[model samples]
Target: MGVDFDWVILGILAAFIAYSLLTKAVDRSLLTLPIIFMGVGYLVSDPLRAAAPPEILSEGKRLLAEFTLVLVLFADASHVRFSQLKQNWQLPGRMLLIGLPLSLIFGTLAVYLISPEGGIAMALLTAALLSPTDAALGQAVVSSPDVPERLSETINVESGLNDGLVLPVVLLGAILASAGVSDANTDGLAIAALIQIVLGPLAGIAVGWSVARLLDLAQTRQLIAESAEGVVFVATAFAAYVFAEVIGGNGFIAAFVGGMVFGNTYRHHIRFIREFMDGAGQLLTMTSFLVFGALLLPDGIEHATASAVIIAVLFLTVVRMAAIWLSLLGTGLKIKEKLFLGWFGPRGLASILFTLIIMDEYVFANADELLACVSMTVAFSILAHGLSSTPLARRIGKT
Candidate 1:
């Protein structure tokens, strides 16, 4: 495993320019940045892998993926305005509350049925890991003028919040999968999980509230420069994650909770956070996909099984669609609207990050099969959702 720094750097630059130049065309068509970057990485994986240090390839990619997720989680959470959501909260609320759990249940059952040998833990781990949706994968649908405001906002909010909501279950599944491999004590794991859940939010609140206050006072006194706000935004996210981790709590949860607090409390400065996400956040996300193609996807495909592909198909289609459809049953949305919402739940960045976490931090007896299933699902999503988003959104808008 080699890290081709020059190729990676040069490719990123070229892809950035190319994508930027044709941004409108790509948005209007069935193409997305993730698709292009991932395809490029896949096409040149051999050369990229051949030219790098093995250690850096392994650890560096994992860290890059993790930090990307942390930033995404925080930024996404910070964008939510609770006050504005008061009017249209029911749709996303139902999806997060009802649909998310149902997707996990359906996905778990499907994985378990397909690979009974992997056991309930493995099935649960796979299900939980794939539960979160990445709206960026289908940005055209979410950002399209053709899409109704209610529909687009619902999708955006659901995607923004679901990843953080599912992080605990993902972590629990990881622990259980690890325990299955190593005879870890169930009671101790239970205790640790409880503490993690409780303490993570506490740390987040502390960091977020404190930072919000500091920023507020600074702004009031005209002490902090406007240009420095972006730096503060990112630093706050890292502070929350690291603070939680140092205290044995969940870093991801802390980052999200902290972001929620910071965003809501310091609502006036939210623009800076958005700007950071638009630039740094987008770069990190695209880099993750490229790294996935060059590194993770190859190994996942190599370990792919017939059962893995089947599970991936089921997760993307039946599990997700059914969950969304059922959750929106009483919302008075038409059949077409429900189906449209159901189909766009593309699994991308969050799934990739969760899979990378499982690969880096835990040992699973069924690691290869598990990873292959996740990779295939994300790859399928990039194509299926990315291509369908523009056309479907336009069709829905017309209706």
Candidate 2:
């Protein structure tokens, strides 16, 4: 049966609607839907005697992953409350300052020792890619009213900010790995990276604040319609991204900063915008997982050596848990709170995006190994953390 473009679109839409309805009746495991859809994609793509060709699926997977990440980064940042962040600054402060760097160091060392084939540069790149936690991966913990609000907020804030935080490290590492660290242009590239990091958020704040003020003025003058508010929110996010990039800033950082500033400045407008984007973000996220299943998983698994797989598993489990434990040291959170936060630092969307960005750079001669490490780690996290998030949160809640 030949399928037209409209038919294909309609089929996907119907499948998603049916999947959504089914999820209502099931236990709603985090990895469950992703695993299911991935299986579906795999089965469809597999011929009796041969695998589906890469050319058939690679572009679609890449585009879906990128779009999902853009929406997810914006939505996650938009949910942050600057006031709340200020009041409960200790947890996030320690996590970013101490926990993050420690995690990167530990992860790099772990990768280095475990994957001797992947040298220090590849090891460090893998570490940077996996260091940032995926907030959406552990939604049950962060979103739960039962979880200690401080702990929950800290994780949420950390996840929202860290992806942007790690961008400079990743970029610097890429440049160093691609061009020897001692190259003459390294200093210039470092300066450029610093500018991107600093100016990205600054541009975002300016554009976001201006847009928020304009929207408020329009609302006061009764010049804006309720129906058009959603469009305005998206336009503001896109403008932040475009303007930041035009000036050599990180567009992802701008999206996040734009969302944060907009969230703070237009508190009343956020609920509507967030609700609209939340649905869209979830859909994009699901599509990302499906693509992961169909494209990255099989290829990553096939390319992954024993050492790479071992490192990926260890990073998701021991390395992450250890970093969380140490990071929470001076915060005075209860052991239970600390442990829950530690184990739940699941890597997800951000890792995937970082992998894509690095893949584009063609930095590592061992790009295949690097991509394999990243893909395996992220895939494992989607299963391991997703399965455990709900039960673990409930257990901690009881304590």
Candidate 3:
């Protein structure tokens, strides 16, 4: 019943090649890259389990999840133009500032009442984990010509920024959950988190600016190969993340801020950098989803209870929609537009990464149930959002 690692690699290779060929067609249909890979992973989970030990598999998952998130945050943030952001920051700003906090509050309340097994700390933790939206999940809509530019940009920007913005909250949640919020040194934790947040961006700026200057000198002196820029670019991301972590800062935030600084500073080379990173990112993303389906999803599904399922449903729909709708009140968007924005807040990579972080770092009385709820929400989001994206993007494009 054992599957060899060679066979597993071959299978993944074949699946990726086939998917690449059918990518355009798949994009046109309701099926998505995540759905496809997740299914493939689920189907092969048993065989893979026979091949790898639990600890090895867990470590593999952690590395894959972390690297995937690092690249994603970096790439996404790099694409955001500061000038454009300044011009259109209103919509995303409101969502991040007003909508995000409301979502956290509402999500915590919902979890507290609906899934009381985890207590308030777990409730807050879960809420913080799920609050950030995933741009990868909404790629269809954001990239679609049919969707309004402003709308797509708003969603894109929100996704790019919110994960970094909320990382502290997630850290706080874990600290509080471990110590029990009442017994925890809440003030000290807050100060520590605040310091990490501040230091992350500072490290990012230093890495980004230094790297950009080096690249500029190299290019000017014709000392570096065009092909090698990609290597440097990827290295910069890792460097920013590692440097930040070394300085007791949040790596993800450093990656994001580094990307922003890199993108802005290395303007002439952005296209080359993105071309290389995008291909790599796509591969990492697909592999991460595959691992998720094979391991995380199964575990979550197995441990999920009735309350977990209920909370999952509410978090995706009621909690998300209400927070979005309320945040856009004075923006004068039509009901359909508001709903469109609300509905597309799909949970994917960030949530998955946060769940992994919880599994690794935190000890919750209701850890299994907490992850189950988040996992269920992510699964539902993958299907619901994937199926709806293309058609909805088309529908909204006409309006």
Best by lDDT: 1
lDDT of 1 at 388: 86
Candidate-wise lDDT, in order = 0.88, 0.75, 0.86
Residue lDDT tens for model 3, 1-399: 568977987887899999999998998788999899989988888878888788998899988878877887887787778888788888888998999999999999999998776778889999998888887887899899999899998999899888877777898888778776344355576677778889999999999889988888889889998889888888999999999999988888899899888888874657766687568778888898898899888889899888888888888899999999999999989999999999999998889987886678666677788778888998899999998899999999998
Instruction: For candidate 1, give the lDDT of residue 261.
Output: 88
All candidates' TM-scores?
Answer: 0.96, 0.88, 0.94
Arrange candidates, best lDDT first: 1, 3, 2
Task: State the lDDT of candidate 2 residue by residue for 170-225, as single tens digits.
Answer: 87677666664333355476677788888899889988899988988888889988
Give the clash count for each candidate: 2, 0, 0
TM-score of decoy 1 = 0.96
How many clashing residue pairs are found in candidate 2? 0
TM-score of 2: 0.88
lDDT of 1 by residue, 263-284 (tens): 8888464788888878878778
List the lowest-lDDT window of 10 residues for candidate 1. 181-190
